[model samples]
Target: MKRVQAALQHFAQAVAAAMMAAMFLTFMLQIVVRYSARLEWLADRFPILNPSLYGWTLEFCLLLWIWLVFWGNAFVVRDRDHVTFDILFVTVRPAVRRWFIIISGISICTALVVSIEPTWAKFYILRLKKTATLSTIFGDWIRMRDIYSIYIFFLVAVALRYAWAVYRAVRFGVEEPVEAPAGQPTK
Candidate 1:
């Protein structure tokens, strides 16, 4: 399980990194193309220029942004880095803190479990729709569902993490470990 999780963590990080690079390259290419389109001098000088420069760049970037947001949530769960309103949690007694942690984990798990089916149905319906660029290029369409695959993975990943947390809370007291045994790994 640990090895599988490590692999998934590495894969997610790679995907995130690749998306960031692709977005940067796409934006830079767009900027160059836009400037070239504006400047008659550049256009006349470079006969090879496609003033449109893969008009799908914007839509692609937006798609990448969506995946990045969703995947980042999964990564946060893997790393246990999700933001918490810790002031109240910090002020509480340890026993109260355990209850708070367990309750919050249960609430999140409940919400996610409840929403999963409706969300999947909505995404299924969206499979009928095509992106603007695909619609323009091909009368037939690429399914929006295919584009949103990462989001489904992200939801399941975070939900499972929450469920695991709840299980851990039940088995082991929920007060976060503050000290490490000698030579033990942290986090």
Candidate 2:
């Protein structure tokens, strides 16, 4: 199970890296194409390099960015990687910290689960809306819903993650070791 999870984590990180690479390449293409219009020689040599030809690049980059953010947060980024104001949590006793984890995990899980339905409803409604450039490039098949679908995946992944954390907290007081403040002695 540990190996499987590690494999999944690596796969997810790879996917996120691929998305970032794609976005970078697309952005570079957009820049080159945009500037090519100002360079007559380049434009004449490669008429297809017209700035208008790569109009889809911006939209595509934006689409990839949306997926990258939600997908990375859901699968690639770990809980400890997130920023948190945990001064109170860290100051508390181990038992209180465990309770805090349980309560917060439950709250987060509940919020995410509850938002799923409304999120889906919005996505369903967005199915009718097509991206201006992407739809043209993809033969009108790419809808707003398709682009935003990663959000649903993010919600589900986070809810499940929190649920697992809550379960672990119940079974074994907070699994993470609380970091002591500066000058503080080890408990």
Candidate 3:
């Protein structure tokens, strides 16, 4: 179980890194083309006429952003990196802290379950209608909008992982370390 969780964490981190790189490269390329004299002619030929004009670049970048953010969130949950005001808990007994964490985790899981289906259905409708800003064999047929499904996928993954973490906390009564804020002493 630990190995599986560790693998998932690593995979999410790698995917996030790749997505970030892709987004950065796409934006940088656009910037250079717009600003650099050497690329002026090329830019003029392929002016940013509209969101549609960027075609795959825009769609792919948007998808990458969604994936990166979602996956990064999953990573955060799996690693228990989400922010919290645990100062109050610090004074409480460990048993109470464990129960509190479990409650919070269950709440998060409920929210995710409630939201995921509706959100996914909305995306599915958009995809089914072949909705897109740009029309092309590559964009329309391949349907870049379908990529939005990844958002739902990652959200579900994160929710499940978090729920599992909560269960582990409740059953095993383990409290992961909390990092001290900047300039604060380690407890």
User: TM-score of the candidate numbered 2?
Assistant: 0.91
Please list all clashing residue pairs in model 3, or write none if there are none. none
- Which lDDT tens digits does candidate 2 get at residues 46-98? 77886667878989999999999999999998877787787898787889989
Candidate 1: TM-score?
A: 0.81
Q: Tell me the TM-score of each prediction against the true structure.
A: 0.81, 0.91, 0.73
Q: Rate the local accuracy (lDDT) of all candidates.
A: 0.76, 0.88, 0.69
Ten contiguous residues with the weakest lDDT in model 2 = 178-187
Per-residue accuracy of model 3 over 1-187 as CA lDDT, tens digit each: 9999789778877778788887999787655544553555564675653333454566567767777777676564435345657678777888888877798888988898889888977776565565354354254565534666667777788678768879898779966556789977554
lDDT of 2: 0.88
RMSD (Cα, Å) of candidate 3?
A: 4.3
Each candidate's clash count = 0, 0, 0
Stretches of candidate 1 exceeding 4 Å from the true structure = 1-3, 41-48, 76-80, 134-141, 176-187
> In lDDT terms, how accurate is model 3?
0.69
Query: Where does the lowest 10-residue lDDT sum fall in candidate 3?
Result: 47-56
